[model samples]
Target: MTAELNARLEPTGERWTLVFIRELRKPPEEVWGALTDPGRLERWAPFTAERDLGTTGDTTLTMIDGDESTPLPATVRRAEPPHLLEYTWGDDLLRWELEPSGAGTLLTLRHTLPGEDGLGPMVASGWHLCLDVMERLLDGEDVRAVRGEEAKEHGWEDLRDRYAKMFAG
Candidate 1:
């Protein structure tokens, strides 16, 4: 756990940035697989991801609104399997950096928003939910559906609070 999980906000010219870091009791390759593999991503994320992962070329990741079946375009900037993944959403940059930590892996997520306006909160919640789903999936838990509603209703601050309580032992 880190300060990023507290919903700490960083000022970025016009936009705001949110960061989240977690240490998993799993290998970097396993974490990387869940993130870069479409089959694994669909097991955790709300939308079914379709991408040409494990390749050098850039790919598009869409966050499909399951209810509406609409796709939100997400651009993949860089994908280095088992190491890093960077994607762009609107004016935000979503990055995942993985490193081996002791016997597990340390995952750091940096989500930068373009402005401190409406997009900030939405992005925060979205990232929070995604992270939550990732956490569960990594633990071999079943989290098939998109839990966006939790983020939508609670907002960023509430998301942190809920995660703290839900995951706290």
Candidate 2:
């Protein structure tokens, strides 16, 4: 299946915010579980949650691949369950907002980066694949985590080129 690259980039002061909006066929609560539950996240997320992330606290996010799969310290800035969640990962902040839309959930992800720095398209491409995997999972389809060479093999390079053009101006 062809992945859809539907993220928007906005300049926010010294930083740039990349927003990904998705309309899921599942409800907010179900989507929330996928976002917070470790078991469900492992099927789609790029990292595994070491603990429950439904509360505002600290947790470890273990990288799913790479030799540097070491757990990273992460802080939950806010959590509202089935609605809103904000957290920090490395030098960036990630926020997820869910809202009921029709019979499904409208999920919005706001990823704040220090700067555009030519990484916007690359990052957007990665998130595009992750979100695609998540949506497929929610739809009850068997999907594997896409990354590295697998990502490029599955049209990630095309997405990167599209996003690069989108973020160019």
Candidate 3:
């Protein structure tokens, strides 16, 4: 939870959107692999994609929330391996952009929600912890995915409050 908040919000009509950025100490290819591969995703992401997200096609992702699982019908609208990938999980769009930065990879995640429900802080905090878990997994550290209700054990509430203040001021 001590990690700096790296999320910014923009109002688009009646919808709310946020961009979460993370710098990983790995190449784009490696980072991309983590993003598209199902196994790698399970190691960090809160949801699990049924197939490799590196391809442009239809796929299903299951969002894990405690003991409940929500099946989200998704489609990969754009897929440029090792660089950019855009997909839809249900009605939400998730666009990922990766760029090489001094032997590392700069990851940018653009997530758009349905409405301006003041949920930016909650979403940003979730992504923050997920990205942190991803970074550690990329570094060969054995860490499980920290997400959903379980994220509270990993300081999600604190992150949410911190992000709320950040977005407010």
Candidate 4:
């Protein structure tokens, strides 16, 4: 399935926000588990979490780019199980809101970045692939994570261009 590029920008004090929404066919709890559980996250997320995200506490998120790995200090600010989750990844703030939508869940993510580095489209494209893989995994499909440079094989650059055009006008 082609993932929709449903991303928008908003002003939030000193930082900018990338508001993204995706509708999943899975229940809220299932989607919440994929977002919070380290094992489940590894299956779809681009980074690996050091601890369970269900609890509000300090954690580390390691981004593996080829053989290079960068460890970023992160903290779980709020975790309300199947409803809400707010966390900080390095200098960026990510807030997740989940609502039950019929037999599925409507997932909303607000990614706040420092200043306006013009990274909104790039982040939006990256998240589009991540959510696509997440949707496949939740649908009981065995698929490898298409991230980083590997994302080019999955039309990430095209998606990014699309987002860029949308944001520019």
Worst window of 10 by summed lDDT in candidate 2: 63-72
Tens-digit lDDT track for model 2 on 1-169? 6556678888878999999888888999999998998888888887889877889998888766644465778999999998999998777889999999999999999999886647788888888888889989999998777755567876788898999998775
TM-score of 1: 0.73
Ranking by TM-score: 4, 3, 2, 1
Candidate 3, poorest ten consecutive residues by summed lDDT: 1-10
* Candidate 4 lDDT for residue 91: 94
Give residue 118's error in model 3 in angstroms.
Answer: 0.8
- Is 2 or 4 the stronger prediction by lDDT? 4
RMSD each, Å: 5.2, 1.6, 1.1, 1.0
Q: What is the TM-score of each candidate against the true structure?
A: 0.73, 0.92, 0.96, 0.96
Clashes of each: 3, 0, 0, 0
Tell me how candidate 2 scores on lDDT.
0.85
The lowest-lDDT stretch of 10 consecutive residues in candidate 1 is 1-10
Candidate 4: Cα lDDT at 124: 90
lDDT of each: 0.66, 0.85, 0.90, 0.90
**In model 1, how large is the Cα lDDT of residue 71?**
53
Off by over 4 Å in 3: none
Tell me how far the alpha carbon of residue 52 in candidate 1 is from the true structure, in angstroms, after superposition: 3.6
Model 3 agreement with the true structure over 28-142: per-residue lDDT tens digits: 9999999999999989998999999999999899999888889999999999989999999998889999999999998999999887748999999899999999998898999
lDDT of 4 by residue, 16-106 (tens): 8999999999999999999999988888887889999999999998876656678899999999989999999999999999999999999
Clashing pairs in 4: none
